[model samples]
Target: MNCPKCRAGKLQGITLKTKQGAALGLDQCSICGGVWFDRGELEGYLSGAVEVLDSPSLHPKLAVELDHCEASCPRCAKPLAKSKAPQSPRIQGDACAACGGLWLDAGETGGIALAEKVNAAFDSWLAGLKPKA
Candidate 1:
């Protein structure tokens, strides 16, 4: 499969196991180091059930700005809907409504994990604050 974002690299399948021991196979782009999640695969990462493998070279390219790029789903061949990753407005990803698939650019999966951690910590801190009398 070809990468939905770069459109140049072929996607290679990698097996990932969730915390609950459920195995999932996802596609990773060789050139851009992006990842493609099918259906609910991203949910596992959001819920802290999956561990993302380290891709040190996954960095945003200064030349390829995706803020306004219209990407197509590699699976369905349909135009993907652009949206910000949860808790990280700076990191944008494309979702395929037809297939419920998600495309995360280079370094985005790690960014999402970090953002969720920060948000959770902030929420906990806020909840612990006492009401001002």
Candidate 2:
């Protein structure tokens, strides 16, 4: 499969195991380090159940600037919609509305992981907050 974000990169198949022992198949780009997750894969990964290997740390100076580039789903050949990662406006990626597939740019997988951690922490803090009359 070819990467949707970087057309030059060929996607390689990989199996990711969740904390629940569920094995999920995903495609990743070799050249750009991007990833493609089929329906529910991203959600499953973000559910805090998957034990993903530590992705390379993010460096502000090395960040890749993404443009409003048009892309299609490698699975279905349908147009992909651009969307932001929940709770992290700065992290944006493409999604296939038809197949529910997601395309995360290089370093975005880790960014999403970080965002999920931050969101979880905020939720926990909010839960501990006392309501005043």
Per-model TM against the reference: 0.74, 0.73
Q: Write the per-residue lDDT of candidate 2 for residues 1-133, one digit (tens) a residue.
A: 8877658778888777877888777788776677887876766767644655333344544334433467889999999888875534666788788887878877777767776788889999998896866
Off by over 4 Å in 2: 53-67, 85-91, 127-133
The residue-by-residue lDDT of candidate 1 on 1-133, one tens digit each, is 8877767889998887777887777788877777888876766656545676555363355325643467899998999988765533666788787987878877777877787678889999998896967
On lDDT, the leading prediction is 1
lDDT score, residue 96, model 2? 84
TM-score of 1: 0.74
Model 1's number of clashes is: 0
Compared with the true structure, the alpha-carbon lDDT of candidate 2 equals: 0.72
lDDT of 1 at 74: 91
Q: In candidate 2, which residue pairs clash? A: none
lDDT of each: 0.74, 0.72
